[model samples]
Target: MIPFDLHTHCTLSFDGKSSAEDMVRRAAELGVKHYALTDHVDLGDHADPDFDLEATVSGAKKLLPALREKYADSIDLLYGVELGQFVHAPELAKKLLSENDYDFVIGSTHNIRGYDDFYFLDYKEYDPFRLLGTYFDELLESAETADFDVMGHITYPLRYITGDFGINVDLSQYAPIIDEILRALIKRGRGIEINTSGLRQKFGRIFPDEWIVKRYRELGGLILTIGSDAHCTDDLGKGIDEGIAVAKAAGFDRIAIFKYRKPTFIRI
Candidate 1:
């Protein structure tokens, strides 16, 4: 098992099944030395009504510190959030980040402008390639400006487009955009994550694939993080060992853990 998980969800997230306390307790039981409860905080046009940004961040802020103290002896629980669609609402995103105290933040773009999350979209109605182009462009914008510790699930669309719908996507078509996104992240000293949730889901692979991970390193990007992106206690840390192996293959000897929005590297 990996020693830490940087992205995870609890009851604070709309789709989460387990409570924060239960999730933390279970992480300790499984010998996870470092962990984070990175519940979703979606923003702007695509955000649903159920995900109250203030409530989610405040709840995590109020609850996690106490849990961190309670489990101080057994686990190093970090307070974190997955801040989605930061490009859509720059002022709101800046305000939220400035006001809150978060140990880690996963920057993501769940959908393009005026569209639902890829998971909820009807694939038959739209051109997947066009949608992917928009997604990467939006992500590049987010990478250029969003304040985040790491970019979450860079290949998120493939989870549905290829994994669920069985549409074989030639990502090489978007290589230029992908390179720009990676360059933006590297220029700003931000990193990308190897999200392992895809391994268990229909995708059957880590997000962004090994090529992107290696390319990130090749382009002078030094920071990388691994996460299960687990939404429940049972799924926490799942496929994390495989995530580590991928990181190693990508030429990363150390992975990052965030505290106070700054990165600290630890050997894998």
Candidate 2:
């Protein structure tokens, strides 16, 4: 069973449509013991400079307490954020993370160095290999310096590169750099998440794939979290059972959860 969903987006995200209350209620119906409401905050050149995190944080602090009390009996609602591209805005990232005591923080690179979001880019206009190389480069920068609890959807852009662009890029060429990213996270005592959104998407696979998870395990990286990256009610809890299976196949015995900014292991 998929016990908890560690990565989810609610109304706080520009693209998300569901409210936190709705997400938690849906989790209860789905028997998800724990659920995280991880909205987006992209500070890199890709994100709008006008993005207001203070307002979002304030709104969350206001509603979360009541939600927690209401769902106390049925679900564990995790208040979290998906902070993207912190390498481009380290100061702002630190300020937001320092000021807000989040239960979970997911660091991701949704925007490349030149493109703000992978979704907005025209994959046909660029070489897939070079573009993906730059993608990994930026992701490494985020993993190397950002203060986040888990790395969300490591191979996110490939959903587009492989599916939309119909280009097959070999991951072996980037294995060395990928290992560096995993080691960096390992050294910091951080974690990597098994994001299952791609399974429902055209990618038909989880973010980071199986080899990446196994590689992290080989590097002695233990903390693994699972999430659906759901943006709507219907997508909630999607692909999570498969995610746990992937974790087990990668040789993980448990999944990690964050509470009060610390890691807690839960048997999968």
* Model 2 regions lying over 4 Å from their true place: 48-51
Report residue 190 deviation for candidate 2 (angstroms). Answer: 1.0
How do the residues 16-60 of candidate 1 rate in per-residue lDDT, one tens digit apiece?
999999999999998887899999999888788777877888898
Best by TM-score: 1
Model 2, residue 106: C-alpha shift (Å): 0.3
RMSD in order of candidates: 0.9, 1.4
How does each model score on lDDT? 0.91, 0.86
lDDT of 2 by residue, 18-74 (tens): 998898899889998888888888886668665676677777767776788889998
In angstroms, the error of model 2 at 186 is 0.5
Q: Which portions of model 1 show Cα errors greater than 4 Å?
A: none
Q: Evaluate residue 57 in candidate 1 and report its C-alpha lDDT on the 0 to 100 scale.
A: 84
